[model samples]
Target: MNSNQTEQGIRTLGVDIGGSGVKAIVLDEQGLTITERSRVKTPQPATPEAVLNAIASLASEQGEFERVAVGFPGVVQYGITKTAVNLDPQWENFNLGDALSKLLAKPVKVANDADIQGLGAIKGQGVELVLTLGTGFGSALFIDGKLVPNLEMGHHPFRKGETYEEQLGRAALNKIGVQKWNNRLQRAIANLEHLFNYNTLYLGGGEAKNINFQLPESVVVIPNISGLLGGIKLWQN
Candidate 1:
């Protein structure tokens, strides 16, 4: 709430673009919440143009803001998307940062949604791994507050010819029932622990709310709002 922020002290309008919905929230320079979260259903077909329109509409409901931070459910590189994953193929290679900056008339930064989530969840020390289990599995790794680029760990092999995402995503949970899905998640966690040896692990995304078992001392479940909190940090150098 100072000169570094907007006239109203709003620093950034954070947008989280997921497979099912587009959500936005306003935060001040100090990372204090400045507005109620607003959400819009992701359009049918979920094409780039459709999602773009949805984001614009969602942003409009949040009043004024100086900049934007977008958490996209895809492989985003320097604001350019490299993979579609759960989104439309048209998103591949799309320069999303440039597109949103132009559309919203505000500076924009975009990154893998899970990576943004990690920014809000991590203590910025040791190796931290964040996994989001929703429409799809999303992951991000960080060490001492620095991101190690993007890791599409979800698509990596897990079981017999199926990927981790294929086994742990929301669809898998609904199709297999909660108990079986939880078993798959247990195995996934053990596998990830052995592989990454992370100091902490954070579970997030919409479906994370349904987790019914206790996690290890080092593992924690974070709310999806962490992704919006990350938008504030996204502006930091």
Candidate 2:
């Protein structure tokens, strides 16, 4: 809709790369789309090269996009990953934005996967704490509209020699029954509330969608698929 964003065609597309898959969506200036979104398997090993190649291939199929944004599952420093938890060890110390940008030959932006999803869920709200319940727990703190990157709070010990992610994530959900699961969820929320004082807490990602029990007050459940729209905003900024 304006001069600056016209080059990327993301005025036409936004790509969300998750542990399981890569999602691509086309959007207008208002972040609304004129076409349907697309998704494909996220490469395993989830290494810098494999994921980058997958993104490049996906981008090629969609013709051309104005800009591309990827969500990495790790602690990101200046668009390069300083640490990767659930992904390939090779991902650690990788320059993802630069790598992907070179491959796509376009403007490419990367953020901790959950942060991008979190930003997508807040509908572009400047600041909020987002806890994404996926393969591992993804937590991101957005301060004054900037994503601070990896916060790995999931690995913090909670109980019984298990970390918070182990107690509350999907793997743990199946292992723990409803009563016990909600108990941990409650404690996790309490901890987050105390730590961040985030006015809004958005719970997104695949597992958040299957939440069966009642959520605590002020905790919002956002559609997991909705993150694609948020990815669009990354370039707009």
Candidate 3:
């Protein structure tokens, strides 16, 4: 590896804060996991302070690390969260990166959870889209490895005047049953294909495993771990 690669290869702490869980892992510069993941239930109410404590606790167990990267289940810009759909309202407008940096005493970078997942999954060749089916639907778009931040496609009207998240998220999957939810997902995929004309689509998040139907050739199912693995990309530049 080159000097830059060697420098980056130092340990990095990657944290993914979701609606239901907070997960952390240590990674090498190349985004390979160097330690087993550490996770805890997201605290009740999941306020900024509560979630911060959870993340900090997990980080504390991760051993020494040079820097930190985070993936949050919301729209994040410049380390500040702009929206929190499934999380507590207090998360909106929170400077999560700054807060975590202070608590962890390490430089931190943060982005939309799906954006991070896409960074770990995309092939850097063409228009790519990632959809995460977890507590609530999340989306990320990319073109030749360049991220289009904060897409928030989940809030867009999909069918029956309901948002995509209403019909596709984990709650929806549970309410509608797996078979029906899978049908809705298939239809949504078709709609998205025409909307973005993306070269590839990656499906992830906790609920992705519930998909029981055949996916289109252009679509691939990615592991939920992609959210944490993609953390390294935040520091690549």
Cα RMSD of predicted structure 2: 3.6
Instruction: Tell me the TM-score of each prediction against the true structure.
Output: 0.95, 0.84, 0.96
Q: lDDT for every model?
A: 0.89, 0.74, 0.92
RMSD of each: 2.2, 3.6, 2.7
Estimate, for each residue in 30-107, the C-alpha lDDT of model 1 and write its tens digit. Answer: 677777899988887888899989989988888788999999998889899998678788999999999999999999
* Full-model lDDT, candidate 1: 0.89
* Clash count list over all predictions: 0, 7, 0
Task: Report how far residue 170 has shifted in candidate 3, in Å.
Answer: 1.4
Please give the lDDT score for candidate 3: 0.92
Name the best candidate (by lDDT): 3
Off by over 4 Å in 1: 1-10
For residues 36-115, write the lDDT of model 2, one tens digit per residue.
Answer: 66777877778778877777767766665666777777787777887776668898788888887788777777777787
Worst 10 residues of 1 by lDDT: 1-10
